[model samples]
Target: MFGPWWKLGVDTTLLAFEAQAVIGLRLAKLAAGGSAAQVEAQRMVSEKVLAAGEAAMQIATGASTGAVVAGYRRKVLANHRRLSRAPKGAAKP
Candidate 1:
């Protein structure tokens, strides 16, 4: 902890992760043996996926995504509501 005062403020974890990811993507691209256009397309797709993940993170922090979850939950509750009040093989008089 006493090595350097400046080192404590800087965390290299994310920088390391990005470096490793670049290496991994390079290896994957080489293994694919595709044309330049295909490699470019793959790169674009990966970037888009990263953007989507970022958006999901933003949605997680915001209050709007809850509405989508609530809509699905409401449908599930509607489906089960009738079953709770009625028994199978029983008929109304």
Candidate 2:
């Protein structure tokens, strides 16, 4: 049925909104200043670029919107877990 596709569309929209909010918060934190703020900003840019490239490749290979979005959600959650466990001022290499 069309129900699944409709759900996927809604989920994708929600994901996009969540990602933007998180990115905005990160930018605000960076602007507020910290020893590792510069590194965090650079990491954010690199991560987004890499994720976009991967998503584009997946779409080119005929992956569904749901699949691409799920992948993004997984990556974002993993990064959140990793960052949460790290020391406050530590920057990952």
Query: After superposition on all CA atoms, what RMSD does each candidate show versus the true structure?
Result: 18.7, 4.6
Off by over 4 Å in 2: 79-93
In model 2, the clashing pairs are: none
Give the per-residue lDDT digits (tens) of candidate 1, residues 1-93: 654433422323333444455555545555666584376467656765765675577577784543434433443344334323534566966
Output the lDDT of residue 55, model 2.
98
Tell me the lDDT of candidate 2: 0.79
| Candidate 2 lDDT score at position 91 | 89
TM-score result, candidate 1: 0.28
TM-score of each: 0.28, 0.72
Residue-level lDDT tens digits of model 2 in 1-93: 999899898888877876776676676668867766787888888999999999999999999888999989877766655554656677887
Q: Give the TM-score of candidate 2.
A: 0.72
- Candidate 1 yields a Cα-based lDDT of 0.49
Runs of candidate 1 with Cα error greater than 4 angstroms are 1-34, 63-93
Highest-scoring model, TM-score: 2
